[model samples]
Target: MTPALPRFPHGPGSRYTARAAFSRTRPNRQVRNINLAPLVQRLTERDQWLAWMLHEHRVLTTQQIARLTFPSIRTAQRRLRILYEYALLDSFRPLVQSGSSPEHYTLGPAGAAFLAAQAGCDTAELGWRPSHTGRIAYSPALGHDLGTNELLTLLAARARTTPAQLPLWLSERSCVRRWGDLVRPDAYAHWCDDGWREMPFFLEYDTGSENVARVEAKLASYAAFTAATGTRPALLFHTRTASREAALRRRLAEPARNLDLHVATASADFTTDTPWGPWWLPLHTPTRRLPLAELASRWPELSPAYRPQASDDADSALGLPVPPLPPSDQASRP
Candidate 1:
């Protein structure tokens, strides 16, 4: 008799074998030729806005861009493909062990030139040095930056549906320009709603990579910022784990003398729900997670200097409907 065939424990159809087979046979699409002139001519104001955002933020994934700029994911993907093909945006896929990572995009040379002309400045002045951007694209801090951006992108998406508007999203670079000596927040945001006026905030995104002592040191800097400006914006710390949140809270509880500041901490998992919802646990009151709107109530002592101005032009620029303002103190929270 012929030698018995080697025994197969789970036959030849195990899940692992099937996955390997599928991976080997997976289809890869070829890049399609695109007409440059027509694509450039078809670019709309919104498209330009997207490019400007990329230039400012350095890099954003397709999902983040979709949430921030487009009405729907499908529309975003279609438009992004066109933009990519026409060389208005450059993208790269990071190496991952499992499923592919979302393509992260940066402003292309042509797009940068267009923005430079629009701003009446040179590309270097607009911070569009290709080499520098490329370096940033692959930097180790990229994940931290992306995490910070995702928080803002979620707010932008909410603005499209709710009666809220994120009128201003200042990048870290912009923050440095404004207050580099005092502190550099991951990002600064101004939120406005029917009830709430422009409420400015400083976002500190923590990925649990830094030591707790370092985080506390940063808090000291924010405290210094509050003392100088006399306008203490809420410091929102988005940490990577519950343990990190606990550790941060402990450090926050024992702040330096004469350093009274408002701070809130939340884990990264909270992003699964509405980012502006009751996700933030204020250090002053660690028992409950308060919504973004209610954060002001937690710090009644803070007299914010930044005020939201009434402007039809601003509303139009954001493409949001102007809601009737309720009769309430512009500076006071109800």
Candidate 2:
């Protein structure tokens, strides 16, 4: 959290107008609890556009903010200019990146005040509602498929067995907050155990393996997370290649020991039981594409010991067959 800016004291003659509002308490250095979901739901596209502007707070490039939000780079740039002219966003430009001209935009003080007020609310009632471009909004539907309630349920369930705390990655600012810029995780999670165990997990959602640079960068990021959190989190990768997985872990292990991670594949050296059932499971399945809602409905039937004949193939439905690991790696990795 950044230090609170100085506030002017109320003068004896100062009087509030109908449109003006005043804060009763001084701003705390710590983040005051607020319901972000309702705040986000109260916003519209215009609000998002404006909020994105404030994210940089007068220092981000237009191109950068666009890339962060819109579908395409060109579209992001175009819309950004429009927002600026309409007084919704502020921009400054002709800067350099690797020696090229670029435009930067950010939220003005007016925008900042607006967001701060919204941020000040009851923590218990507020929740995170993420936007389509992956920003936290204030609404019931924080993100697309996984609404706020659904997320709470799934997170609560994961909390039961996973021995690590679950920290949220609501924004880049959050990364800066917990770990500082020099050392921070992709997301922060501190297990809410008796001792309040804190572990920062590195999350990588891979769609395909084309971006070598990105993968390498994330590995470096994990290094930072480990240094800041004082413990290595379970490296969680959604879907990735065996070779890629091995190489990344190998690189990560050099810097940090006591590392524990989970990568789901069709075959592995370990057979673990889950809420789903007890069986040797692949990280990725070949055919079980059941939607999560359907899975929730039929969750009663699935136990650690339960396995369906349909899931008989060790390579169930993740597209690849479970390949037997060579005796060496299997024994090493759990």
Alpha carbon lDDT at 49, candidate 2: 43
- What's the CA RMSD for each of the models? 10.9, 20.4
Off by over 4 Å in 1: 1-40, 192-198, 256-258, 303-334
Residues 1-334, model 2: lDDT tens digits: 2222222132211111011111122222222342334444444554454453344222344443433334466876766655444333444332112354344344532334335454453222222111111221111111111221122223333433344223232222344543455543333222232233232234343323235455545556555554554554444443223455445544444333332222222111121112112221223221443222232222222211111244443341211111111122223332
lDDT (Cα, tens digit) per residue for candidate 1, span 193-258: 557545668998887777888888887788888878878787888887788788888887778334
What's the residue-level lDDT of 163 in candidate 1?
A: 71
What lDDT score is found at residue 236 in candidate 1? 82
Q: How far off is residue 224 in model 1, in Å?
A: 1.8
By lDDT, the best candidate is 1
lDDT of each: 0.66, 0.33
